[model samples]
Target: MAIGDAQVDAADLETVAQQLGRTPRGTRAIASRCPSGHPNVVQTNPRLPDGTPFPTMFYLTCPKLNSLVSTLEGSGLMKEQTERLAEDPELAAAYQRAHESYLAERDAIESLGTQVTAGGMPSRVKCLHVHVAHALAKGPGVNPFGDEALALLREQALWPAGDCSAS
Candidate 1:
């Protein structure tokens, strides 16, 4: 699959389901893939087939990555980052831009008529998973916190060394 490709095939869906350990609802595309060509991030619809509004547009699917992010989250990274947002004006501005960009992208797909973007953007760091997924899907230099989280993982040698698709 190529970047920004909206097509979601059956095999990819199956792989995503296996990664998630459940059926993925409102997934519109495989947003990003791991080195082994497995869906690591997914672009989801603003609304589900059942007409339920879903705010998260990009979702992380690789179990290894998910677990790694969870570990980071468990380390109180989100709370620390949220505190930094208040003291760091530049980072706060960049995060606001990220939030706006996320809203625009999701609104383009289908508006949920709300300002809510995922991961508590614009003011706080809520979920590193959403940030990492956004960073992977859109590439580097978009989400500051996401880039920071990935850097932290790399610096700590916590990043997965093998194919993360195999779980």
Candidate 2:
């Protein structure tokens, strides 16, 4: 489910903390949830509470999804996607748009005065976890790499197999 920057309550924060194994800093809202209605993606503040510049606006918090995305990253998918970005102009354009969109959303919340978006966007694929989180939070077609990663996960039968809520 898309939570979309709505006010997060104590239970949600507690769940996010459990998922991260620490208290989440600068969490503005629960961005998205898994099939079991547990927060899988969170919309974070552009600048963290401690005055740190946080470029990652969308963060994936689901352990199951994190593990699966890590598997994809370990398989050198990032390198392949990065290479494709150099060769495919259309893809590069789409990815640029995604980066711009991410920046606009984050800047709307709080401008960090930087063009750097998360997950090596518009140029390379650095983290599938971030990409997947972006796709999950914004839905498909927003981020090409993100959409591709989600599709690959689904094709591999590694996504939506069951509830991913923390026990």
Candidate 3:
């Protein structure tokens, strides 16, 4: 699997489309991969072909990871992280940095004309999926809350990294 940069091939796009139940719009490249060499994360364009403002730069396309994140959200994990953000200074700072990094990446792709990055970054943790995608795309130490959330999933044996690709 390519570690950081992966050209979004037709097979990869097809795989992501199947996983998501629809063709992804504005997909620029695969940002990360699963252990079995399938794409797990993708970097999207700020603007779609239809000129829609798609601010979400990095997106997770792996069905297994998406399911795990959905389960975490169903379990009130997002709320817990939001509360923790208000309480932990270091974590809040790191999350803010993640927000900045996300903006920089998106800006590098196209001027999106908005400061609001995905996953309720810098202020709240509304979407764990986006944060997890960011962490997977940018790697660890970039998104602290994402790393923590992924750690929680791993701790609970909920992470489906390698097994999904086998299927």
Candidate 4:
């Protein structure tokens, strides 16, 4: 394993070793035979029911996992906020007030809809390239463009540490 790789618990490690007819040390020796096979270096480490380690390991790009975790965490936070707002009478009243105001504004707009238009016909215009730049960014989990440009950016960012000079 690398100097600071994530690891499964000792109990899980022992269980995996036992299932394979080997000691925990032996299993770790085999699994960590190389940095590539090490749990810390790898993306995933499986454990037995009792939280023992398993032989097989799976690897994935860390940035992808980071993006997924961030998105899921945000979703969970939003869910909690929504639930709390639903259960709070003060918040509910505020929401109801806003809802009524929105409805009144909508009705006013509808009443005037026919008066505001292009030659008596309502028309909608939108800005071009509104999201173009945003869509261009290579965010976490996004490996677009085959990582070449991103690798260059990464190198430029690292500079002396690892060639992180921006492309």
Clashes of each: 0, 0, 0, 13
Pairwise TM-score winner, candidates 2 and 4:
2
Candidate with the larger lDDT of 1 and 3: 1
**Which ten-residue region of model 1 has the weakest summed lDDT?**
1-10
Best by lDDT: 1
Error of 2 at 83 (Å): 0.5
Better of 3 and 4 by TM-score: 3
Off by over 4 Å in 4: 1-73, 111-167
lDDT of 2 by residue, 93-153 (tens): 9999999999999889889998999999878888888899999999989998889888998
Candidate 3 accuracy as TM-score? 0.91
What TM-score does candidate 2 reach?
A: 0.94
Please report, in order, the local distance difference test score of every candidate based on alpha carbons: 0.89, 0.88, 0.84, 0.28
Error of 3 at 152 (Å): 1.3
Q: How would you encode candidate 4's per-residue C-alpha lDDT over 48-153 as one tens digit per residue? A: 3355443222222122222332443354533443454547766445434433432343234233222221110111111101111111221222211112222433
Instruction: Give the candidate order by descending lDDT.
Output: 1, 2, 3, 4
Deviation in Å, model 1, residue 5 alpha carbon: 9.5
**What's the TM-score of every candidate structure?**
0.94, 0.94, 0.91, 0.23
- How much is the lDDT of residue 159 in candidate 4? 13
lDDT of 3: 0.84
Please tell me which model should have the higher TM-score, number 1 or number 3: 1
